[model samples]
Target chain A: MPEITILTEQELRQCAAVDAGAVEIVSDAFSRLARGGVQMPPVMRLDVAEHNGEVDVKTAYVPGFDGFAIKVSPGFFDNPKLGLASVNGLMILHDSRTGVVRAVMLDNGYLTDVRTAAAGAVAARHLAPERVGTAAVLGAGVQARLQLKALTLVRPVERAVIWARDGEKARACAGELADELGIPVEAAADARTAVEQAQAVITTTPAGSPILHWDWLQPGTHVTCMGSDADSKNEVAPAVLANADGLVVDSRSQCAAMGELHHAIAQGALPADIQPAELGQVINGELPGRQAADEVTVADLTGTGVQDTAIAVRAERRATELGLGTRVQA
Target chain B: MPEITILTEQELRQCAAVDAGAVEIVSDAFSRLARGGVQMPPVMRLDVAEHNGEVDVKTAYVPGFDGFAIKVSPGFFDNPKLGLASVNGLMILHDSRTGVVRAVMLDNGYLTDVRTAAAGAVAARHLAPERVGTAAVLGAGVQARLQLKALTLVRPVERAVIWARDGEKARACAGELADELGIPVEAAADARTAVEQAQAVITTTPAGSPILHWDWLQPGTHVTCMGSDADSKNEVAPAVLANADGLVVDSRSQCAAMGELHHAIAQGALPADIQPAELGQVINGELPGRQAADEVTVADLTGTGVQDTAIAVRAERRATELGLGTRVQA
Candidate 1:
């Protein structure tokens, strides 16, 4: 019988973290993605309309990797009322050569959170100014804190501001992050106030309408929008892309369908024929990211399956080395 | 923390079997699929050409069910030389309301086998003649045996014939089935002789070319072609589909892409615009199946994600009722 290791969220947390190492790992995946040879199909989505929930299935087979990962993520918007988190999932890594189950990471989206944050850090490292003294996060959720924390690893983010529709929740999040990161963090009066004061901004909300406007962006400012993953969600105004000096996306095809670029093209703010440079291309030096120090760069991150496979492989290897998780005959 | 049940193949075998109940379960899923309101995504496939392997991911959300299932199946064709099974993977059942992981079934293709065989029985029950005295199965593999056994659940099959490219393996399979089913079973001289002796004929081999020709099919024979699930695989000649009196498919769109119909359409044996009735439609009485006793019917069984969800739900329920798995904090 083949053996499979089942690692829980706690075990996975001990293996992978949202730090410089994770950023580098994700960056390397992006570089390879630009060079080609990765087999990644379009994301499979299932909407449970009755339960106000949705599930997305993603996977990628990267060459030279011993294993590939398949990740299943479910989001129930009403789960908070039931005393549960909104997002939870598990990742399965299979041996590439034998197609055997190597490990099952019941991470409950911890690894996704890490990988997503690392992706944001990669964007900042490539597009943000040399020194980012203040970083603005437009959400009061788990991703807001992680994105800011990850930004600190890539940029000199000495202070941060939190802004959300609910001022009290934003204040609470800001206070928590202030102590956690040992940085001066405060809740902004509004989205405009947050964006106007920062050199680097990250949007991490599930908003259906634009919360950040084009007029709020300053020269040399870098924005990483990670909220608009679905067709219905939009974090920045369509004009933001139209007016930006540099536009990049994690996946150009995916962004054209569901990202901020989708809204831009639909609203006629950007030409329908426009094809922005992909983050992978910029990472591999095939295309430039931020051409000038004063250019306003925007990186729309809709996420990709390659990041999931990379993080899952890293977590499984570290957990196995640490002797964590339960092993059973598969 | 949420709790997740982990059931291995041994535990799954104790919970579900390829019997009448399994057939009914699968039949009801087909009926539901025809009635509408089922959220099933297209199968996601990853081809690892270097290792001669492939992985397919399938999932569906059926209304009124408490949970849905996502199945990951991997087939490495070269694994048999390394003393390993070519096909093995796991299924996950998630709560529909909360989007939380409820159970993990590590059946390693056992449940898939039972579900697939049950689907074959479903096709035979609805499309075959009322009295099926003899059944012929092409192939000497595990599915060939299970398909024959499942036919006995729906029809009064007293005798069976086994045929394969390897005559010795066919003879061995015939002996095993004769002992297991308590029925007279024999190895046929060729595919023609096998189909000529039985009222119900099933094709279960993964042949890329036409293994069963049009001229081999006898009058009043009901054929269930289950081997051509991929684009490159074809079990029966295109003329069989063109000459059949009644043709049904599990999913019209899927069959047109990768099933026997795909071959027929490509060869111009069937019209490019042909839209055959689905098995679900026939089961729900929306369309006709086996119109007459002497009708030469062909039911293409390409399989569907709804079948996986049905079988996984049944297995999890039975396993939970019997306390047949290990429960861990998810």
Candidate 2:
């Protein structure tokens, strides 16, 4: 039997990160997906209502790639009461050439957080305004901070605003982002205020109701709706999606099934039969991105297996280069 | 983050097994499934034709169970030419209470093999004839050997016959089973000869075409079609399924989607809308198994995520009892 390598979170963080070329890797993966060069199956999502938790299993095999990843992401919503962070999981990468598992990434959800942030960066790079000064994020969470840190990889921002249902968490998130990114980040007075003052906006809250509305958006703002990955979670209003000049989704079918697009279609704000263009098409230059300087664009990133596979491939390569894992036969 | 436990194949073998109460655990799981207490989604199956590889992700949250399992099973059909076994993978067990990962069973496909074999045994315990002196198996592979070993836990078998496309592999399998089980096992002249001499027939090949026909079975013989889990794989002919006195499937929906029943329905031998009795129903005593002494019963084992979760829960319990596996926070 072939041996397997185990990469812990410490090594993974040292090797692959959201700040370091993750946007490029995930951006390329999206391009391949749009070009029909990837084989991605429908995600296997299991809702463990007993624990108020849900797990989504995602995977994809990219043609010509030597490896693929089966990512297991679990969100335990009620974990905070027990002093737990509420989300956890890992990614298992296999040798696509032979179907042999080559490495087990015990990332404990860090990889997912970074990859998600990178996906947001990819959206910002392709759709955001050329001269972005200030950015706004709806949500004070790991992603709120990580997304800002990641967006710096694509768009330059001098200041940022954070809005959250919990006012204190928003202030804390803003402070953390300011310290980490060395930029002027502060809490916004309201979601509308945040949306009106920024050239780019990223929604990262797990809100069950519409938190960002169409009327609040600036004319040329590029919005990355990144929270509505489940049926019950909607971060942006349906009108916001329907009113956008350009709308792209990670996967049209998935967006229609579990993302913000599903809620929009359910509410009759968006047509049920509309086949939205994938963000990959925009990234691949097959579709127009930011066609006009004042065109309001929205990218729905419900997440995709292709991103997981791409991030994992890069992580493994970097892990190997740094000699940062233990090879075990047992 | 909660700690993660890694249970290797060696420790898994020493702690838990298919013959040791797996049927009871899996049988209970099946009953729960039949009672609508299992939250099992559609399987995520991705086929990579470049390597003749296919990876299936199956998971279920069985209500009232303290944990669930997400199983990643891969089959690379061309691995045998490189002197490697074609099937491999692992199971990730998560705590139901907090949605935290409890253990990683690096069984190297051992758990899958055993759980599958145990499912066949569960079928035999409920549906097979009372008086079984001999058994026959088509296709001499890992499953072929494991199924016989598992069946012994449910029925008293004195002898067995093996038939395979490769005559040499069949002879070798027979020799190995005979020496291992202390029973008179030998290769059959043909599939018909094997079927004619046994009370139970288990077909375990990944053949794309049918190997067993309707006319090949005796009166009172029970057929377990265990190989046809994919759309392109078949073990028994459609005519055989159409002619059976009783036809039960592990999962009615799955069987209709991509199992032997799929082929039968496609060929018009079985009605497309006919909802077959689930093996769980038979196990739960909600439906009849073998109605009469001369009745021919066939069980289509498409496999289920419920069984994986049940087996994984048991394996984790046993591993914990044995004080096995390495614990880490990653």
Candidate 3:
């Protein structure tokens, strides 16, 4: 049996140095998916409880491959009260040639969080203005923090405004982030205030209600909506989507059912023919991203399976080099 | 943080009592899936050439309830050379309520193999004749042994015939199985002779070529094809599928792509609307199974995501009760 390399969160965090290399890998997988080189089964989820609604599971099987990853992400709203952090899981890597076990990655959702943040960086790299200086972020959660960090990595964002329902929490989160990133950060009093003076905005809240309004967003502002992964979840108001000069998404099929686009379509605010450019196409240079700096663009980040596969592949390699975690022989 | 339950193959084998219970849960999941209560995403694999066409990464996410299992199962061809088992991997259970990581299951593919075999048994129970006195197993592998054991648990088989390219291995495997089950077992000289005397036939070889012939099967012989999960793989001759009185499979979409049915259709032996009954439908009484005692029935065992989820859920519960493996708080 080949030695299967296990990657933990710490190892994965260290591997971030080479993460730029993974952008293309993920881009290619998505391109293959679009070109019919990959097979992505329809997303399916089981409703374990009424409070949780439904947990969505999505799978993709590439041919001539022996490894398959199953992501079991549950939506448990009551977990915080139980003193547990939500969103924890591992990614299992398989050797497709022999159908043997490869390695177990105890990602604990760190991979998901990082890959998603990296995707945001990918989106901002191609879709944001060439001279991005200010960013407005909605929600004060971990994802929100990661989004800001990822955005700054790609764009030259010197200042960021954070907004949340709980003002104190947002202020504290912004203060902590400002210290970490060595940038100016402010806690906005309201959603409008956050967007008014920003060149780009990212919504990372799980609010089912529309929070970002079209009237609040400036013409040159680029919005990256990372929430609304289910039909019941919405972050950007439908008008913002309708009036945007350009729209981009990780997967159009996914965004059609969940994501901000789904809500926009359901409300009859956005036309069905308004095709969003797949982020992979933009990354591959097949499609133009952000046609004009002044044009309003929204990159809907509902997430994709290809990102999970890419990160797993990269993390496995990095961990093997760093000598992290336990190597299990299969 | 809640305690995480991890079950290795050894622990899982010690808790054999849970296997039967797992079968019931899997059966229910399949039934629900057939009834449209469950949804499964497509299976995706990432092949790393260093691993010899085996997938180094895999992700499967079922969207209905936000849960997915990512597994890195390597190739078996490398195991004997490396002095290890070919099939190994873990399953991660996520909480849908909060998208939190719930439990990490170091199944090492034991649970997967058991669940898969149980599915074969479920198919045999509904499709095979009530008096299945004689059975022929075409492969002398672990799956073949498990299939026979599971079949015996569901149906009464007086004798079993085993056939493999390697006669000695087949004999040894059959002898060990017979000693365990206390059933008469014999090694057949060839594939034709094996099915000729048996009322039910099972093909579990990983061979890409068709191994079984249609003419050798008896009128009432129920055939279960457990191999041929990839597009390049096939176990049953196309004529065998064409001549069957009724056909069934785990999932229609999967069978149409990579399952045994896919091979038959690709060869122009089967039509697009063959409309094979899902095993779940038969189990749920939503569709008729074997119509007559002499009817030739075939059930394609392509596998489904529902089985993975069901088994993962059951294993997690059992491991929790037994206090097995490590627990990590995320």
Candidate that would win on lDDT: 1
Candidate scoring better on TM-score of 1 and 3: 1
lDDT of 3 by residue, B1-330 (tens): 343444456666654332467668778778777766453556655444444534322333333544444443444446667666655666666554455555665656676788789888888888898887889999999888989888887888999999999999899988998998899999998988898999989999987999998998888889999987788889999999899998999889899988999999999999977888899889999898899999999999887778777776666666668776555433
Write candidate 3's Cα lDDT for A1-330 as tens digits.
Answer: 245555565656776432456555555566665565555555555555534434545445544334444454555556668776545556665544555546566666677787788788888888888776779999999888988888877788889999999999999999999998899999999999899988989999999898999998887888999987778899989988889988889889889988898988888998876688888787667788888868999999888776666666666667768776665442
Q: In what order do the candidates fall by DockQ, top score first? A: 1, 2, 3
Pairs of residues at least 3 apart in sequence or in different chains that clash in candidate 2: none
Best of the candidates, DockQ: 1
Give the share of true interchain contacts found in each model: 0.89, 0.70, 0.43
CAPRI class of candidate 2: medium
True contacts kept of 1: 0.89
Candidate 1 lDDT (Cα, whole model)? Answer: 0.91
Task: Write model 1 residue lDDT over A1-330, tens digit each, in one string.
Answer: 689998889889899999877898789888888888888889999999899999999898888778899999999999999999989999999998998999989989999999999999999888999988789999999899999999988777889999999999999999999998999999999999999988999999999999999899889999999998899999899989999999999988889989999999999999888989988899988899888988999999998988998899888888888999999886
My TM-score estimates for the predictions, one after another, are 0.98, 0.96, 0.77
Q: Write the per-residue lDDT of candidate 2 for residues B1-330, one digit (tens) a residue.
A: 578888888889986676758988988889899998578999999889889999999999999789999999888999999887787788999888777888888888888887899899999987789887889999999999999988888888989999998999999999999998899999997999999888999999988988999887889999999898888888789998999999999999899988899999999999999888898899888999989989999999988999999999999988889898888777
